[model samples]
Target chain A: MASNIPEKYKTLIKNNKRIDGRTLDELRPVKIKVGVIPSADGSAYIEIGNTKVLAAVHGPKEMFPRHMINEDRAVLNVRYAMLPFSTSERVRPGPSRRSNEISKVTRHALESVIFLEEYPGMGIDLTLDIIQADAGTRATAITAASVALAHAGIPMKGLVAATAIGKINDRLAVDLNGPEDNFGQTDMPIAMISTNKNITLLQMDGDFSKEEFKTALSMAKKAIEPLFEAQRAALQKYYK
Target chain B: MTLLYQNMQYIRNNIAKNREDGRTSEQFRDITIETGIIGRAEGSARVKIGDTEIIAGVKMEIGTPFPDSPGEGIIMVNSEFSALASPDFENGPPREDSIELSRVVDRGIRESKTVDVEKLCIEKGSKVWMVFVDITIVNHDGNLIDAAGIGAITALLTAQIPTINEDGTLNREEFVGSLPIKEIPVPITSGLINNTIITDMTKDETECSDAIFTVTTIENENYCAMQKAGPSEMTEKQMLDIANIAQKESKKIRSAIKATVKKHKI
Candidate 1:
């Protein structure tokens, strides 16, 4: 695999500890806040390590462009974007191929849990903006977006929590940082419903043996538990 | 609309037994592959899975490598969903569906290192051969991802590298050798309908499916790429079972591709 990481940072793990001093299967400090943007119907902010993302939900309102209206259910529109200043290099404004792909997959990740059938002839627009990024921006966006949907009072089967797991130096690790992501051998991002542990979104790149994939799946499941709790706590704190 | 509902109902009712096409829950539709169909391209193949048909063509060009991997060549996968393929498709820029399809297929080939990209380098950091696999969906039934994946790998396996002229220009007419291939990755897709996992779904079945998963595996029966799509959730156990099925099915498809390549004497 081609990587741009400096030669000095090639070593990601030492004595079962990552470069960031977290053990394998450990996550970075996560902080969640709900109802951050009062202008939006629902909104939330989340920070996972250095990555920060904001999600806002609008509608169950009238859908425009007559052709897109769904009579049987509400249409869900999700747009994911990384602000130009989100990364060290300025990402040009507007959708790039990578952001477009992430937007599509993020929509898939959240669509399964929302009850779009309740509001016929309506539309729900969810926007996720990455304010800062290190790695796992998609997962962070998803975790925040689910909370935003809940804060918007949308009916859902369950909250969705997501995380990325990968192999760094032949060791399975959870929640990769930027260097680990670029330098590692594999990275798999997964999302699941909090209530029933039903997987909603899964995508992987790089190589993985059968056993390694199985282990990584279990590790992702385990890592998502705290995210689910954080989402619940955020909602509860807001309601309280 | 009534007829469509009836067809969906019938499939759902008989999902546990045999599908409308007489395929069991884990069975795939008949697959046929034809190689070297396009005379203009370096390599090309047409693949059909049941009613779904797609043509994949490889065009090699001389290009500068990316700054990060200047010593290696580039492999790009692109898909075009022609409006003629299906009524739902429109003539416009590539939509999310086509983007996801191409990216997933790209992931399978790139992640598995199916093509030895390093060998295409001409002058290390300066120039290299860029392989472009362009997929055109001729017919839309279902399981386009798997079919496209097969078509891409098959076309790439048979592709010939263009030779360079004496003055540092590409000689499109002459072939130096075959493109280096290290592994064969096969993608298998399964649809979840009424809680039943079915492989190689038809158009109607895909329309009724609650969700779908595509898993790509290599020769060792280990997975290289996976994507779960649509608007439904799946349990971990169900996903694991689907992965197992993908592994088992990939072998059969890989062998089929090899036999076809051998028959064609590529």
Candidate 2:
């Protein structure tokens, strides 16, 4: 298939209209559920438009059997899984190259937000399972899982808020869904600490000119604030 | 020597009369599992049967079809037991025990036609989506079949299929909704120790028991699979006892799953 840029998209971007006809900077609706799993130490389920993710936090006890015991930090074990029915078609089971990379990157993103030093010689296992896949699984997982950890009463420095920004048809867009991601020229997933606005994780796949990447980066920074607020709101709702 | 053997026999008799956990022969340990633990997975869950902990995650991807099933998508289940969970697990490919666990769980889900694979086809006879379900045992207490089964069902229930536009594009914001879930099949596992049957056996009991049995409770009244994983043989009377216990306890397991889903308010 030829990559023909849609004329309507080109014109809409010039006029600042999104594919769904929203403003260039607008985000889709977000819903967050916390304490969703009674058995987990902390758990949350988050939905951003069609993308859905669940995060559960367990333990600050028992160092993993073989890792060198550190007296000052907790080991974070993170894994990301997507359902076969989470998308239009089915996906293969097991960690794909993409999911494995996402799991590592997400773990780093979260480590930046947690006070690992608070509990040395122990481990906290954080798992993010996607019940559905849309576009922003990594970002949604990071943001939602932080709320779950907080709900589990695990002491953390602050919440990690994340979002994806991309460029499609020469236009910058925030929170790209699956179609936009597949056809989009450049895609970037960004994670930031809500407390101090620190950029903890940044990953970009696909082609992007420097200018486009910079614009997308700025858009991602702005994109994370609402996500941070959403996490806070979810916690409030469940706590109240 | 005779006196020592007699003391051991007396201990066994006492346990047969009274369970170590203080529950009756038909009693079960507590169970709890939370769905959606892995962020990258489309549908995910972590299940706990006392101390036996299993986390299952489902992920979707678009890919070419296997030579045979071109029109329908696929659902594959993989099970891994981390060495941290037990020293018995090696660090390479999946061991036989893990494979058995995955196969049994997959059998219940696939045999029941829980997921409508026909609906998952994006472009028939050429390309289709593959649904991957990954189950990891973080803590191996006992009765993994039941824990994995619940995790798998919960993940599937919460799973959604994206809207595929006729224009050869996907409507990212248009949530087409969940796949066809014909029934919620749950597995109830019991341990048979010294001629006694107990429901939802814990890790300690399972390790100390002589045999383990799993009864997959499907629909409201049907059993899809009855699996026994131990060297000991069960008599007809003992089997009847286990079947009765499974029938009654399966309801509680199902209700827990339903309540958790409702509480998550998803």
Candidate 3:
């Protein structure tokens, strides 16, 4: 492995290639299945190529006392779990810093999309399980989980779509895979309301030059169109 | 609430020729197990039984080898009793009851030898992967053994080990799929209440039961471990009857697990 990001990223950029062999804007295959778990109020099984996420929604129930009960808005509790064997190496059990960060970001993203104010004093729990992982887990979870909530007939403002853009060798690429992610100089995951283009969650790891960041942001926004369509197509299959 | 008791009594009075929930005593609650949840962990699963839900994440790490078992990987099962599920659990270290729960769940999986521990060694006598199976009780309705066992086994079955290079580096493209376990272990708990052995006891039944009998197995026919809990002593006939229930019900649970594994093909 290259010790520094600049050297590795430069090699990929110079070769006109990505670590996963995709062009700068290509995405892995996205497959979404709705209502996999019969017990949950609503559930979805979404596979973004090798990265698999299962999102279940249970809610609009009375909130427990002692916890912060939102009388004017519903609470969203999202837990993101990646099975130890979801990757090539085993990970430590419990919430790591990365997982915790993603969980909070995912919660914020979905909370913005869901019409929580309509179900005041109740809470809706969203659980996202990553059975297989390659990259783009948080983005995949946010996308799938929103679709699940909408399918559950919980009032949702609009669909939220997310994708990551990163700087690899001074080049901007949308949707970084595991290898590119590790070696990339910067990664920015953006969650947006596809309908109104509202930004819900934004997280970036590593630094990007201002111009490079702007290019990546443009690439990420452009990448959302197809994903938004696909998410719509999935919910339509179940709801319509 | 009154209607609930009426239904319970209706089922109880007809116990001789009928069963609670309209099924035979030798029956299990509907079970659903899904794998590959939690992307950061190597393997993860969520197992549900009726209203009870448990999520288990198996994480692997390379650490200094234990002195006695330098070549073998260590399996550790940690449990979190969340007050979110029940008021009895306060936020702190695991209580004695939770500890006992963890021990019992760990014993079943460990004694079954589900994972090939020897293969987890990266450097013999220097470093080996410590597989941590963390089970979180999201809801505590009843029969966590089956839920935990299902989660643990499914997580193991879906596990993938990254290919390690000679210089102790992980080659990103190469993956060894799934832990090589000789057999998948299935556990089911049966409760004896009112001199009756019920398969897949509910929380209420468990709370009021005289004793509880739990049997763990690789399949319906092959046995790995058995646990008996509760207060009431069992007669010889009841033991035989309960064993028969375990033997019969084990097949159903085993089949469900196998079908799930086959469907997911992790």
Candidate 4:
């Protein structure tokens, strides 16, 4: 069989340890800081492993152009972009198909928690810019955006936490890093509201048996707890 | 306003009984697949589920592979929601909705390894066959994702690889064997409306839906891709329940597709 495996690494897992030297289910160190940007209404910065992202929330203000306004509830606009130097190969500085898809899913991930109905005929804008990417950038972006929204004092039902789960070298792992994501058999990014364990966003690609899928979902639930706590801590620290 | 409420009430009542079209909650709409619809294209298929219609065409060309995967060929999917498909569609560049649709369909095919891309590599890093699938929404009744996905795979299944002369001249009239297809993946979408999980949602039902989930399954009932959309949150129980429904429904759809391809002698 022709393999797309990178030649740099022989195997992703050895002796129940990942190439990054973490256990199968261990998450990379996460650091979150809120109110990072003074010019914006609210902003936050986060780093998970090598992936760094900044998220900013703009407004629950007037809906521009009038036609896009929703009388029953406010409209949400999200933009996700990776900087030119974010990856090893310099990415083009513009919205790409991948970025567009990520923006839409990220908006859906945050929409359920925000009280859009309170500001009818208004619009809330959010932007997530990836400063550095290893893997799981979407999950990192979602986590940062949640904290930024909360920092803006936007009323939300609960915080949303996200992470990626994957299978590498015939074993399931949580919070896949760069190499694991590239050569792994599966990558499933999931976002959840931790209070009630409601899933807000989910997207998966690659091979997975039904049983493996169930296991991945449970692993995602477990992986999200620390992220949820990190978000809460960031918000609490800022408010204090 | 009164009319809208009454219509919603009627839909709710129908869901309580059967569906508006008299199908069960988990039942899918009637599916129709027609292959080789676009004669000029390398391969093409038109698929319809109930009133939703989509046309997918495949075009192959010689191009250099990406730097990361120089040994494998490339497959790119693009979707267009023309104004003719629905009143809401506008004449402009691709919107986020259409981009999402294309990516979701592309994931199902790419993740399943439906096309043996390595076989299309003519040289180690110099040249490779670039397969492009363009999906157009002809009618938007509902569940365009499933319809478009089916159309794309059906088109690819019937595609023929073109022969290239040693001097790098193109020969469109002559053909090598069929494209290398390893597996077929079927995407099934389920919508949550009024706490009721319904498959094959119609346009009216989709407008009122709280959330939608799509799961793509291949042979052996393994899930290769999935996407959860809409603005509502779903409990774990609901997500898993939808996945089960997708798995069951995909089997029927796969068999139908296989039968259709067999009848066409492709």
Q: Which number leads on lDDT? A: 1
- Lowest summed lDDT across 10 adjacent residues in model 1 chain B is found at B1-10
lDDT by residue for model 2 over B124-242, one digit each (tens)? Answer: 87768778888888887667778888898888876666566777565544557775677777767776667677766655556555556665656655555545555343443454456
What order do candidates take by lDDT, descending? 1, 4, 3, 2
Poorest 10 consecutive residues by lDDT, candidate 3 chain A: A1-10
Stretches of candidate 1 off by over 4 Å are A3-5, B1-3
Docking quality tier of model 3: incorrect
Writing each residue's lDDT as its tens digit, candidate 4 over B12-113 gives: 666757777878889888899999888777888999999999999998899999887888999998999999988878889999889999999999999999
TM-scores of the candidates, chain A only: 0.97, 0.90, 0.91, 0.97
DockQ of each: 0.75, 0.01, 0.01, 0.75
lDDT of each: 0.91, 0.71, 0.72, 0.90
Q: Give the clash total for candidate 2.
A: 34
Q: What is the per-residue lDDT of model 1 for residues A1-240, given as tens digits with 9 covering 90 to 100? A: 564567767888888889999999899999999999999999999999999999999987888667899899998889999999999878899987788889988888998899999999999999999999999999999999999999999999899999999988988999999889888888899998888888998888877888888888898889999999999998999999
CAPRI rating of model 4: medium
Q: Candidate 2's residue-wise lDDT over A1-240, tens digit each?
A: 013445543343446766666676777788999988888899999998789998998988787764546677888888888878887778787876456646666776777567788888888888888988888888889888899889988877788888877766667788887667766665667677777765555544444443454466567668788888889988998878
Listed per prediction, chain B TM-scores read 0.96, 0.85, 0.86, 0.95
- State the TM-score for model 2: 0.48
The TM-score values for the models, in the order shown, are 0.97, 0.48, 0.48, 0.96
Runs in model 2 deviating more than 4 A are A1-240, B1-14, B66-68, B162-175
Please list all clashing residue pairs in model 4, or write none if there are none. none
